[model samples]
Target chain A: MDIKEYKKYAENRSKRTSSLKNCVLAFIGGGIICVIGQVLFNLYSIFTIEEHAKLLTSASLIFLAGLFTGIGWFDVLAKIFGGGTLVPITGFANAIAAAAIDNKKEGFIAGVGAKMFIIAGSVIVYGVSFSILYGVAYYFYLLLI
Target chain B: MKNIIKFPEPVSIIQSASVVGKLEHEGPLGQYFDMYEDDIYFGKDSWEKAESEMCRRTLSTLLAKANMKYIDLDLVLAGDLLNQCIASSFGLLDCNAPFLGLYGACSTFAEGVIIGSNLCSTHQIDRCAALASSHFCSSERQFRFPIEYGGQRTPTSQNTVTGCGAFLLECTGYPPYITECVIGRIVDSGIKDQNNMGAAMAPATVDTLMRYFNDSGKSANDFDIISTGDLGKEGYEIACELLYKNRLDMWGKYTDCGMLMYDYKKQDVNSGASGCGCSAAIAASYFIDKLKNGCKDILLIGTGALLSPVSVLQKQNIPAVAHLIHISNSRN
Candidate 1:
């Protein structure tokens, strides 16, 4: 079809497109993303990793997933799974991955490295800000105790 | 828990204007933006930049009309449709408002209002502003892709509104006092159609409304009107059906911003509803018009689908989000 005809039909095509293939793929992709978490849960049974350490592993896995997403691989996976790749914690990993990768392509100092941490850095700042507030509140609670 | 958050002084909204639908002479180019050298939303210019500029310009005109000193104002609490709020950051650079950038997709306007109202109520700043802006071209490119990239659109897909809307969320001790935030609910109906975002997001609207109704100890009938952000026609009907199916009654004076703007027949407004800007523009412009002319209490429900085109293309069903803010002009 010509471009104009394509534009007219595109809307209809999007609706008619089958979700079955995508849905199955998404389920599989999403399941794959969570497979690591499932393994870590099993490892928790085998070896007594501290709860915090276990949590760190989960976070790290998500971060690693995000790192893959940044490289553009995860997005492709996300596309196939629809919400499967996206609905999980792995989606966030993809966002960070995409940002860092985009920035890196520009060059590290200003482009890649500087830009990589923009959103993540803010999240850290906000995290610290709230943490300090909680710490102060805890100190007051201790004084009352 | 009581916490003190400092903010800049409050400033009145001296003036405001919104551009909606297609412009007369602009041709395919919907609106003029000073931020873009080319002013084309579909080109290589970052969509994040395009949307931000839309918001900045809208706010600038409003501020300029009010003749308020930007330096005198306390802070700008603003949000956008971008995932991490890249548009808002770039948007504020032009307006130069000290900003606390926020993200809630379509809900950003109400989120801005709630925060601004809280700061204003605390008398932290004599006057403060909360604003949310969205643009279709830029949003599509960032989250979906360039419009020209020409992927298929669904009949369920509403054309993304092209303009920006800004609200002056002031704590002018403006009589109504914004005493409470009856938070909107987030419901996700497992509908995977990205084209009919309104239908997918309707469940979130219903869930949030139900929660708000329960929390506020109020019924849907309590408010003068309960308006939704987008949801167009199909979503609106779906929402009604879903509400009825759940045995919840929300039958009166409810409307959607998508349905309100543009004539589908005349303008060929293909999809039933669309993006974050649809609600932002409606709330800031249309609703504000009503409020200025003494409209009473209202519940504005803003909805957003968190899914991107990339995710959809990969066959991901959309997950929806919504937030509700109850605005009242009543005095004690």
Candidate 2:
């Protein structure tokens, strides 16, 4: 085939998948996760202080996400949910716990313990760095007000 | 000079061995493989080590079957998907013979056969060992994502087979022998999707196949089967459509090891099996054996997408190549 001929046809040959379905699924999945957190926050507030209840809400969600990652069900959710499942705190727990489960065969100290933070490491580093920047921005906003 | 070269003198496939993982063992052709390791680790600490051990076992098993030691062979040509081809290096490290490690990714097996054939026909070496291996976990962790990541895989995503194929080639042995080979040229269709490797490779496969046919002055009808390495279903369709456009019809005689790598309905493998082990395992264990007891000639083309994870990250289009080897069982 000629180079000129191929260049014309190449665009048609390549596949471009539709993103609408993934986006919709991700929206629903993210909403469900947030709703679960809200329910947990309300449930814990009756028994504990509001601040502790807020912390417990995130903890429970992370636990649930970790369980899903350990059992290999997180991928199923992530398959449909995509970024919706990936953007939340639960995704962070899934990342860390999944690494541990994946390396379980390699023994604890060398495998699970060492590899427990591969994906989550980057998220934590960026998350902390971004929070500091956000805090500075909020302080300036409060001063102006 | 064109890449197409004919070998008048037959290069013998004296012995072969295949070592496959459990997923492969569950496939239809599982019973035919030389060895099956239920454990992916094979008692090794890491997936890389397991891949190395898998290659080592294939080489050792082939030598034992042929009543020859590593010292008996003049050279060993090996390769794999690992960074720096370390898998092949460590896999065949204990062997006494001189080693030449190659990196053609999934096409390493075909490259081995081509180079091994050249060595044999030229009388540079009497006996040579050509081997390749790939582990799904090791390769995925190296190239794409961590298995624990549970990333969503598209339909175009191919599952790398955790297997190894080893062949002992000599100046003489069986009826089915290597007769011709076409070293493929890199044909970049400007395909950038790393997950759609088949699409990246299909153009190269078509280029090589067309060249082979043009050089031989015969269409696909001349060969019993025109088998490609790892095009799977998508790439397979693309290649066939391209062939049909060019007026060459395989007439359903075209097959791919990727498509044959697993039972599609029963297996969750997205786009069938790939990697150097994909074709090598199938050839060493199944097709080569079939050809040895067959009636006609066959053309085996091994395709590879020559892109590393770094290359993918850089957003470079994947360049691909497909090497061809002609095998004939006819002695007269």
Candidate 3:
């Protein structure tokens, strides 16, 4: 058989990710994380304003993710949670922290400092560029209105 | 043209030893391994060093089993999955014999056997050692991601085996002899997904197996068992289907080291186990034990995907190779 035909056949035979199972698990996992965030927000709100509570809640989740990653628990959690842990702020923190820990052997400046953003670099770049583009577009619409 | 190399004289595998980690120790063939370490680090500070240490201890165990020392060996051929093959160099540092480092990815162990057997058969060397190793933690950080990275593994992805296997080959000494070998050609199957190594490597397995059958005029029925190293479940099926299409059927007799290394249903490993150590450890322990028993002949085809992280990032298609070795109980 030719390469093209074999490629097509192999693709058909290979195992695929179970989208339905992943979706259900992600819903439950993400829901649990959000519920934790909500509880944190309420506890913080008892001591401060709503804005401060919201900021503190996000900070708390990021810290927890980083701590879990450092302690080697985040990957195990992510394995079962799938996208539940990935689509949250915790995932972003885990990404950076994992990279930093992995590259730590190469020393600080070239290793941890440079490669810390390796995974999240693209996300940051596209996010900032699109936000700037949206800001300029909205400013023009506001002036015309 | 035919690619099979028939040895003029049989090279005997006098002794073989395997060292595996906790997960592998819990596998089906766990009892066959010579040594098992519950600690992934093997008392080392870093993962890279742990891999080197595994290789060092494997060679020592093989030498001990053979009742020989490193100085008694004429040559040592070793390889691993680490960049620059550092594991082999650093691990075998205490060896007092001449050494050659090979880089065949997962197929490195078979590649070493082929070379070592050829040298022994030709009388260029009296005794030679072939060793290969891979640590899951080390290979993961180098090839895919950090162990602590919070990312979901695809169903096609394989878990790298944390183990090492060493073999001692001599011109005359044992029953399980290396009779024939076929050095594989690089075959590009146009597979680009890094996660799907089985698909990338299956075509190479087909190419090598077809060439072996055509060159030797031997069918799948000639061997008691034909095993491929580190192809996992996906590649194993594809190889079987492709070979059947080419008029060579290996349905029942064929199996894979990757598939045999882990229990897919019980273990969290997505497809199965992989890496240089997967084939090496299995070949040295389980298959060698079979040869020692009543098993007549077997064929071990080591399949490997020759793609680096840089090559994958650059969008280069994975090029794979499969090296074949025919090991038999009788010298003839």
Candidates' TM-scores?
Answer: 0.61, 0.90, 0.97
Q: Sort every candidate by lDDT, greatest first.
A: 3, 2, 1
lDDT of 1 at B202: 77
Where does model 1 exceed 4 Å of error?
A1-145, B1-48, B175-179, B309-317
**Worst lDDT window (10 residues) for model 2 chain B?**
B144-153
Q: Cα RMSD for candidate 2?
A: 3.1
For each prediction in turn, the share of the native Cα contacts (below 8 Å between chains A and B) that it retains comes to 0.03, 0.34, 0.81
lDDT of 3 by residue, B1-332 (tens): 65989999999999999999999999998999999999988998888999999999999999999888888999999999899999999999988789999999999999999999999999999999999999999999999887899888888889999999988999875688999999999999988888889989998998899899988888888888899999888788778777888889886899999999998878888878899999999999999999878789999998889999999999998999999999999877
Q: lDDT of model 3 at residue B119?
A: 93
Arrange candidates by DockQ, descending. 3, 2, 1
Best by DockQ: 3
| Chain A TM-score compared with the true chain A, each model in order | 0.57, 0.79, 0.97
lDDT of 2: 0.86
Model 1 DockQ (Cα-based): 0.03
Q: Tens-digit lDDT track for model 3 on A1-145?
A: 6778767776777777789999999999999999999999999999999999999999999999999999999999999998999999999999999999988888899999999998988999999999999999999999999
A20-90: candidate 2 lDDT, tens digit per residue: 98788889999999999999999999999999999999889989998888777887888778888988887
Q: Give the runs in model 2 whose Cα sits over 4 Å from its true position.
A: A1-43, A67-73, A80-84, A99-133
Q: What is the DockQ for all candidates, taken in turn?
A: 0.03, 0.39, 0.77
Tell me how far the alpha carbon of residue B281 in candidate 1 is from the true structure, in angstroms, after superposition. 1.0
The residue ranges of model 3 lying beyond 4 angstroms of the native Cα positions read: none
Q: Alpha-carbon error at B116 in model 2, in Å?
A: 0.8
